[model samples]
Target: MKTLIDYLNAIPVEARDSFAARCGTSFDYLRQVGYGNRACTERLAINLERESGRELVCELLCPDADWAFIRAAPPPGRRRGRARNRTT
Candidate 1:
């Protein structure tokens, strides 16, 4: 079976850290689930969706997420604004 890391790694590298950060998680968390040390959580999944600008978890777990809308990545050549929104 393909592992979570397998899926995570498939995500674009630029999307990785933000995905984890938005998920209110860290790469360690990804490693845990990816390495089979933890179970997936709704919060984590939701955060990832928010981070990646994709609608995977919501489509798979919560029907309400389908309409939740995807957040667009900043246009190419533009970096995200200050990292003030981060919580860690």
Candidate 2:
């Protein structure tokens, strides 16, 4: 299993800031979590999984959580950007 540090290290240095922003945190915080200097919260773990396109899965981030059910279910359709308002 790849560790968070492995995932973080795999990212190019130039993209780290943008990637961290997409995960709703600063690269410094992510670095801390990766190095085991800080705890990775459940919310952050989920966000990382979603943002990493499941490359960093919740199962890897939060091993204690029962994620089998999630894997058993089909993935939901993804929507990008803001929803358009429809005029009736």
Candidate 3:
């Protein structure tokens, strides 16, 4: 199986740093999540894609993805609570 390190290595170094900066986080934090040491939250993934201008979804679905982390991607948005109760 492919490792987290392998995936991270695949991303260009400049892209990584640019993403880290756009996320308002340090490179270490990015590494932590990218390398699977930390959880990859939806916000983080969104930030990564938005910031890095890369397709994180593609990366997550890659054959080399860490299943645990890949599964952690947030579920699709659903209407709930008052929003669902309202009859627009």
Instruction: Please report the candidate that would top lDDT against the real structure.
Output: 2
Better of 2 and 3 by TM-score: 2
Give the whole-model CA lDDT for all candidates, comma-separated: 0.62, 0.85, 0.60
Backbone Cα, N, C clashes tallied per candidate? 0, 0, 0
Q: Candidate 3 — which residues are off by over 4 angstroms?
A: 1-18, 58-88
What's model 1's overall lDDT?
A: 0.62
By TM-score, the best candidate is 2
Q: Rank the candidates by lDDT, best first.
A: 2, 1, 3
lDDT of 2: 0.85
Measured by C-alpha RMSD in angstroms, how accurate is candidate 3?
Answer: 7.5
Better of 1 and 2 by lDDT: 2
Candidate 1 segments exceeding 4 Å error: 1-3, 11-15, 58-88
- Rank list by TM-score: 2, 3, 1
* TM-score to native of every candidate shown: 0.45, 0.69, 0.46
| Superposed Cα deviation of residue 4, candidate 3 (Å) | 7.6
RMSD score of candidate 2 (Å) = 7.4
Q: Please provide, for model 2 over 31-82, each residue's C-alpha lDDT reduced to its tens digit, 9 standing for 90 to 100.
A: 8988879888878889999888888888778777777976676557745567
